[model samples]
Target: MLPINFYGKPTIGGVIGFLFLFTAFMRKKTYTKKTKGLFIKQRPEKKCFKCQGFGIIRCDLCSGKGFVFYERKYQRSDPCPKCFQKRYDMCPFCQGNGERSFLGKTGSNKYNKKIFRIFE
Candidate 1:
């Protein structure tokens, strides 16, 4: 049997500490790749003729300003009578931001091999 002193040597402690420190130091290294899918194609900006680029129209009643304070005898807490409530008219089709399209199917060959197995 070996002596307990042999198992508790400073060199053994140093080796374990060195290994722990080396692993910690190695984990700090990082690798990165510029993937093709990461480069997204930005859509070109298109001018919207409906809102004329202002993105909103004047309120028909308040003329788009949203407020008209008038004084008489009675006071009311209602919005402008001319504009009603909403100050902007969103695009009826695109709903304002202007881009519109249907996403098509993105085909994949990974499922091709499984089709024959399912039929069999």
Candidate 2:
């Protein structure tokens, strides 16, 4: 039998305190109440300067035809060499989404607005 103050065995009050602390630490830290989906944590997506938020653009190589014609003295039509017959490829800059995210604000005050994950 040990004394009441035995450090090896935790008291009821100590256990409660520990549980409270653990729960507090497990919570997510945010500036406001979170209603975001459990799987997706969406962020601010700005319009891609190149695609202009259209999610697509005319194929520069094939002129949006998805294929090309060999124009050397009227050669036969063939798949576009650039897009590999797909006519449109994912934009390298915005990955075909035509939108991007701004993590930090720029010189303009309007950019200071934050986009939370709840809008979607």
Candidate 3:
């Protein structure tokens, strides 16, 4: 018999136990003949308000210079204080994806009619 390692990995015993659990759980699931699957409707994409869809905005630390100097006498260029090395980093609000979307309620399908009824 294989030993069960709970946190890290699946042992033979763990797999068997999980299969038994999943089967037991699935047995309790009831499906109605009129039930329909949930639908994921596409939402219109909008530009990220933070970056204005640019995926980046000016780095406030270096004043958009993309670099800074350690000492005026040394006269050397270093990575921007804010952007690290790049002139710009991904917009914090949009996470650099440059788009936004959201889920909305459209009426429920046959399956979720009961679920949606609760919201109303």
Candidate 4:
């Protein structure tokens, strides 16, 4: 007994009743537990006062842990065939762990004359 058209539209049942009321008002709201602060606090590990924490030292000429088998005697010819002496090889100039920055030689020529008077 369905014969409605125009004003009383039945155009395919009004597009399936507006797609079932737009899929029941498109739902998706439901979530809780709002209190974010992750919890992160960790920073404390800096101890290297000239290899005090044993980072590396003692090698002041094979003292740390290298090699140093000594015995010398150059009487005349070919006796000095690199016997074995080695001294402060790595620590020549903070190359080891002296921490550098001795700033000698008049403090780097007074810091290059104050950077050439601040670039002239």
Model 1 per-residue lDDT at 28: 42
Q: Model 3 over residues 15-52: C-alpha lDDT tens digits?
A: 89878877988884433233267543222258766677
Weakest 10 consecutive residues, lDDT, candidate 1?
Answer: 101-110
lDDT (Cα, 0-100) at 120 in candidate 1: 86
lDDT per residue as tens, model 1, 12-113? 666677777779888843333346757433322554455543334455556666666566797545577655666655544334444442221113334534
Q: What is the C-alpha lDDT of each candidate?
A: 0.50, 0.61, 0.64, 0.43
Kindly report which residue stretches of model 1 are placed more than 4 angstroms away from their true locations once superposed: 1-44, 68-77, 81-86, 99-120
From the highest TM-score down, the ranking of the candidates is: 2, 3, 1, 4
What tens digits encode model 4's per-residue C-alpha lDDT throughout 47-70? 334543222345454453345445
What does the lDDT read for residue 60 in candidate 3? 78
Writing each residue's lDDT as its tens digit, candidate 2 over 26-65 gives 9765223446644433322577666666555677888989
Error of 4 at 110 (Å): 37
Model 3 pairs whose backbones collide: none
Question: What lDDT is obtained when candidate 3 is compared to the true structure?
Answer: 0.64
At residue 39, give the lDDT of candidate 2. Answer: 41
Off by over 4 Å in 3: 1-45, 70-77, 101-120
Tell me model 1's lDDT, rounded to 2 decimals: 0.50
RMSD of each: 17.5, 12.5, 17.5, 24.2
Q: Give the lDDT of residue 87 in candidate 3.
A: 72
Let me know the TM-score candidate 1 reaches against the reference structure: 0.28
Which of the two, 1 or 3, has more lDDT? 3
